[model samples]
Target: MFINMASPERPVSNGKRDMEIDKYGFTGGDQYTFPGVPGELPAETVRKRETKWLVMLDNWNIWMAKRFPQLKKRCRKGIPSSLRGRAWQLLCGSRPLEAQSNQSFQDLVSSTIPETATEDIEKDLHRQFPFHEMFCQRGGAGQQDLRDVLHAYVAYNPKDGYCQGQAPVAAVLLMHMPAKDAFWCMTAILTYYISGYYSQGLEVIQVDGLIMQSLLRKVCPLAHKHMEKLNISPMLYCTEWFMCIFARTLPWPSVLRLWDMFFCEGVKVLFRCGLVLLRASLGNVASLPIIPDTYETMEKLRKLDKNDMHPEFLMHAIITLRITENDLENEHRLQMKITKKKGNSSVKLVKRVYRYAPTLQHHGIVQKTGATKHLSSVSVDSSQVAKQTQATLPQKDKLHNDAVTLTVYRPISQSSITTLSSSHTSNQQSEGPNKDFQLKNDVDQAKGTYL
Candidate 1:
């Protein structure tokens, strides 16, 4: 499946016969090239890393449970390319989610989805990584798989449906694995990692822009002042960077390297990268020459210097940044408070969307009665209810003594919660505050670890 860059019959031309492609399948063109584009790792180093990754993959549960920090460290270094797809699935806990689902990828793809979603997905197919061999052809296998993955996702989460930004993200996943696995990995990403970014109002991303601005003010005051003076919003420069997960923003090598850390470390990596880019472009006095005007500044942000963006240098800079998960969370809370004070309706919607945390139970994927439908619920560990809620009964009426209640159960091996059928029995009450606290902790842990 490798691109043959040295083939003589396929002349190196700017036309359709262009044979020059990079190891990552980037076409030979100035647009894809950058100064100091990193070279491939040495054979021995790659081999050693791959071997270590194989061992880690073999004992994934143990590593995730007891040696998570060590695993995070290795992920920051970089994942071996050959094992990256599997590593991503394991890292995000997508495999178990995929396995526990009642619906198969085929079923999802075949089921009915919105026509608008399908049309939007179709339009974006050829646009994503079109220069790469995998998706170069208009109606090729790559495009077809991209279609299925997007279609299935639309079917799976119809509320958010499809966004143009997701095409590039899914296309990148397809480059690493099959459509099914890519779908689940994308599911984990959209459901947990960057949940609200693509929703209708895009409230979360808007709040994040403010958070990034706040971080910039602390970390790089000069850049912050410069942007403020120019009347430039963070969203003006960073929307594509955050929305596409940098797929279209960074060079190919740096994009992959960033994703390696991003999937493991969660969305903080994005904030760090954004801060670094701001600092690199405008923090110093010398940067004035490159960005003398608003237009030039926007251009500079879009097309960063190749040497600065080299995978090794970019990753080093990202690692050195002082931002942390707690920083992001704290800043997010501050932004939300400010937004709430302003009476922004979107903030209320964001709060509601995040309250339940978008687990399997929130999606109604698992049922109480243990009945299954196409892409429906699976009953696992029938004895343990993960969540329960009961309506208060009116004391005056004996007929209204039976309270309506809802119960959700947890799977034995995975972290998702499932819902139970409503019961009108008088004794069907919530599991009390202690059990509710424990269930919330479990859901929080699942969200935190996966992200």
Candidate 2:
């Protein structure tokens, strides 16, 4: 049993699993056992990444069909390791950023040399998915390179500054690209698909969420309810996901899959992906032993596997959602309805204000619109002032100016003229009232003049 020194027929260890290889190469012990060691960053994962990346590439539509005849098959199966960077660039529609015509890529990269970037990049440097081995190096090259590129990008787009969610997405990109190319690709992603999800003021992101919610309510009422029930509102989870394009939640390969679709489809694809996730988990969600809470809802949704994520079905659902009966009917019916009600109310209001316009005419105040609306009865000082103006101004002139000024004045508060002439004015002076007028006209007029 211990004759290894002389024996040619000794058993040897196979690479990953601890299976045996006898004199002849054959896996003998538990052929499929996992290794004791945790996984490491593999040497050449580009092919796998490419194949996954292509899943989202989709058929040639208006944007990609003719030029990308080969994109479909090429991305799905895999890409060669060395070629992945170039392939990924083409896939994400960053062809423009990486365009041979990229007049400013180096200019932009050179601009990243500022001292401010060194600190910001350093802050996010180790913070991004540092636990992953590819991101680690004794020399710290992995993290260093990624941070440098993204920091360059933040310097690159001063408008965006640096957001927390962009790092993981940047790391994934760095895996397959040089720093500059990765930075530009990130640019394309934020500019195109991210909408306003990561903006500095975050108002665009707020509007984008409203848009997403409107889209969701139209397409997936059940999933929308689940989110509302758990208060796992889009505001919470989506901030990071949309900001980073699901980089943290999805594996790198899946991230590629999502981006391929995003590049081809647009922001609408994100909502479709949401629907797909919900549909995928609908069964688990429905079958849950208890009414699902927020975490429960997400856990169920998280269980979604791409195994049966039929792209065709998802695409159909997204495109069809726009063609609604209400949306198609007469096109302007809703606008007309709102306009008609507004019009009728204005007529009644003008008549009421005309009755009071004469009384206020001495003050050079006049009511505008089909009916007139003098100052509300509550503010006697303002009403008296209005009356004095109406009296000084000619009758015709006061009405005309009232129409013009009110058109540009405080928004009409009540839908009806009745409320306009009523005692609705509160005496409390409004905050910033003077500032608003200052901004309204670049040229300030004399206090009492009608010019």
Cα lDDT tens digits, model 1, 211-304, are 7887787778798877777777666766677888887767777888899988776676888898888888788798777676778877777667
Per-residue lDDT tens digits of candidate 2, residues 30-131? 112122323322545655654544553332121131223344334333354455566555544455334433346666656645566466666666655543
Worst 10 residues of 2 by lDDT: 349-358
Tell me the TM-score of model 2: 0.50
Error of 1 at 32 (Å): 4.1
Q: For this target, which candidate reaches the highest TM-score against the unseen true structure?
A: 1
* TM-score of each candidate structure, all chains considered together: 0.74, 0.50
The CA lDDT of each predicted structure is 0.64, 0.43
RMSD of each: 12.0, 23.3
Candidate 1: regions farther than 4 A off: 1-17, 29-39, 344-349, 352-451
